[model samples]
Target: MQKYLSLLVLACLLAFNASAQQLRLITGTVKDSLRNAGIPNVVVRVKGTDFLTATDAKGNFKLKVPAGAVTVEAIATHFKQKEIMVGASQTTVHITLNLLQPLITDSEKNRYIMDDKKGLSEVVVTGYAAPRIASGIHIKASPQNNTEDYSPINENIFHTATDQPLSTFSIDVDRASYSNVRRFLNNGQMPPADAVRVEEMINYFDYQYKAPTGKDPVAIYTDMAVCPWNTGHQLVRIALKSKQVDTKDLPPSNLVFLIDVSGSMDEENKLPLVKRAFKVLIEQLRPQDKVAIVVYAGAAGVVLPSTGGSEKSKILAAVDELQAGGSTAGGEGIQLAYRIAAEHITKNSNNRVILATDGDFNVGPSSDGELERIITKERQKGIYLSVLGFGMGNYKDNKLEILADKGNGNYAYIDNFEEARRTFVTEFGGTLFTVAKDVKLQVEFNPQFVQSYRLVGYENRLLQNEDFNNDKKDAGDMGVGHTVTALYEIIPTGKNSPVVNWVDPLKYQQAKIMGNQAEVLTVKLRYKEPQEDKSQLLQKVLPYSRQQIEQVPEDFRMTVAVAAFGQLLRNSAFKGTATYEQVLAWAGKARGEDPEGYRAEFIQLVKKAKLLDKE
Candidate 1:
């Protein structure tokens, strides 16, 4: 028995020594640099081996490694992979990961870096320049210096102590914006092989109108009858007319043009396109308008100081000299541009900084919070901002939209030359001129007529219930001639609708029946005068079951189809009774006399997109 015991002890010791020699244990914690929080679900794998393990909820990871030196890799979605080496017997390791890329669709892949060698083949070309005829309305849409009567008193008031009054405003969606989308989808092609920016698609139509020329403080107008293809629904047109002002407008102007000249901007659709767009504005500027240009690449710099707008040649030359290279320093550029604008701020005229980019701000101030802070601080200087997104691929739509909202600016995506011309030339007045600020829309459903509804699009624009009345809260900016659209899908009361999913009844409670059926949707608009700190309210009501009105007009139906297409592109959850074929059929009926051939182009785009979808 004693001999057997000795032999067993020797065998156990040998087995323990062999295990220690064959394997080594490794442990570590993975954390995010900015958030300083553990990143769970990170995969840790032994390089060149099948062994793998994931981090715990607390970001702690452990792995047994083979005896010799080995490489351990860590990977997570939306973050760059990280690797570390472990010598034999190495015990603990610590790691920090900084996310390198943003989450976007494949359509936005090559947006940030310019591929000059590829030339202009990637760009979408449009027809001859059709000069816009000013309809005898005395308005200045470009940045300029003048003491014009049109300037509002609150122009320089960033924050005011007085109780300012708010007013109500309404927006009619543009039917033309969706024309191409409808046509393209109807023909079963991808909505133009080119990029289809959803914002431009919605902003292209002109709705009905009641001139603000007199009676009401605010009135809207549209000419839906002009389109031959409209069918099924009534089109509500709202035209925002500019306030009349002479050359000696209200105040001198301070303008900062923040441009992105990163490596991604080397393409003709980016840098060259931007230069051309600005040329249109430079020609329209007056001497009183002070212009400055700030550019960012590997670093940020003020390329041009505040100069007279009349020096069009100099500004154009400066624009032409720009070459794209290096990384993006968007955060730094914002800081510098704001400082320059504030330094030369005019006491009366419009003071604003316009940022033009592909929405790719990769290097500094990359996080949402960091960029938000920079924009929020600049807002305090009474300088408004406008974001003009250009190019595609790596386009940070989510970030651009957020920055624009926080900075009290409007956001528009330019997918082609025509779009650039529209924003910077044809509708220049509405694109740059501010007619209303802090515009908030709240619809109080008549619970008696409607059960529940969901707002389509504008997910990022959602506001809290109390934010509607809070005068201090900043909202969307409405430019002269600009129109905004919001839509809701409602489930009427007492209807056996598939749209609604009933919830379980409360304990000892009976289902409540809606008592009245008079009201339908009540739209409340609250806004501040262009320059004011106070807000005013406007109310409009649509009664329940107006057979005449609910019988959607041709133009309205066409717009609905366009909206449906947008919802489809975004993969929205609220899309109901909307299909590509149905949308195409509806659009085909509304293609009225499209002289510019835009409708035909849309049909082709839709067909291509559909094929891609199938593939």
Candidate 2:
């Protein structure tokens, strides 16, 4: 027994030594060989294993790998992936990638180079449920962007009307997702499922809802119909119409354009496009408006002193002269821009910092928590932020969304010149001015009418029911001309439906509920004046639907079509039998005059999606 014990100890020691010998520390920097700039957010993974890490702001990465003849692959969006071998003796390595296409390529078309090491890895699919194809996108049951940041979608579940009936969420007016999805489609690729936000897509286009006619700043429009996607389910549309402020009534502006000229922003879709976009905005500014140019790349500094907006040539030249280079130092840039805005801000003035970036906040206050706290603190001083996201691939939507949410602002994704015009030119007042802040909504569904219900597309914007009255909590801000639309799919009582996730009947509550015969829901809205702490309240009671699906209004039909399109892009489990053909048919009929051609453009997008999805 003693001899066997000694042999066992020796065997264990040998095994431990072998394992240690196979492990190695790997370090490297990922860079673009042509430009010789470090690439941040590139995924560094050991093939056939779970070990992974991403390159930092400087494109430097570190990883531990099993050292004997192991393969290391670097993955990045739009950049050609590369693979290299690290032997037992190797201590450090370097990876140089060829950018498939620069952000500012000569051609407007996307030409992503395909290679074995370039496509999304197998790991992406296993995070969620089994893969489901959405359009051309291969969606994993769970989607993790590997190196990039994206907030996960926690699909809301149906709540039994008897168990818990209140549904509340912050109103989201940010229309970033629509243009972001359009970016993918125009590039001939499917957008990541998380990028297709249903509410934003529906809110992007203008609808002919009647504006507020009374003293109220906002009006409510409600409609209901049998859901086209799931016949047994009912779709409820709740929309808000805010009074539009004419340009002449708008207050004088103090604008600071905080531009990112980081190396990653050097592409045609980035810095160059930004200059052009800002030029368009410059053309719209009035003589009373003041504009300042501040840029960041490795460091932050003011490029142009505060100039009167009437000097269009000076502002245009300042923007055109700006060039892209160096590393991203977003936190530093933000501080300087806010400082500039503070100096120029006047009482009742439109003081705002227009942050243009790809959401790469590499240096200082970069993380979500840190940035959120800092930006939130800054907004208390009456300095607002409006984030204009540009470019793709390394785009950090999650981070920019945080900045906008915390900074008392809105966000928009500018994919091209047309979108830039739409956001900066056509919607100038909506883009810059704010009428209401901390807007929140709560709906109390009547137990006598509703069996179960689910709110669509505000997954990330959902708020606690009690938060409706909480004046301290921050919520979405409403722009001067911004309109918000929300939808809920309900299961009526006394109906047999699979979606009605029936729980065991309560043993204690035998009492029946008494409610108004016409009231289906009571929606309450709370909002604060842009400068005030206290909130004002608005309420409206919705009656049971009087219109059938075939007779629904055009706005309702168009909204339904857009919402369905978004769900299809997300591969929503709730979108039962919702086909692209149906989406097309419903949207085509709802196409109004579309003077701006936005609705017409949406119809064309649906056709493109149908072709791409082979539906």
Clashes of 1: 76
lDDT on C-alpha atoms for all candidate structures: 0.57, 0.78
RMSD of 1: 20.3
How well is each residue in 1-615 modelled by candidate 2, as lDDT tens digits? Answer: 999999999998997677667667778898866447676656677764434566765778877676577888886543455799887688798999874433222233222212223222211311212122111112221113333445555455567777677898999988999998887777655566667788889899888878787876788887788888877678888999877889999999999999999898999999888998998899999999999999999999999888998898988888888988888889888988988888998878988999999987777657777777767777998888999999875788878888998898888998989989988888888888888888999999887778778898898888888898999988988887778999998878752332232244467765666668678898999988887899999998889874666698888899999999998776564666788889888889988787898888887787777666531
Score every model by TM-score.
0.63, 0.77
Off by over 4 Å in 2: 1-148, 495-499, 502-515
Cα deviation of 613, candidate 2, in Å: 2.6
Return the lDDT, model 2, position 479. 80
lDDT of 1 by residue, 1-615 (tens): 999999999998997678656766678887755346666656666754434455665678776667778888776532456788877667888878754322222234321221222111122111112121111111111111211111000000100001111212223222222433443344443332112334345456543332357532444322222111112222232234324333355355678889999998888778887887777777767788889999999999988898998887898888888889999999889889999988887556678888988767778887889888888887766788888766544455546666777877766666566666666666666666666777777766554544444454443355676888898877776666555655454444442321121122235433353434564655677778766788887666665543332244555555565666665543332233456776676567656665555555655555555565541
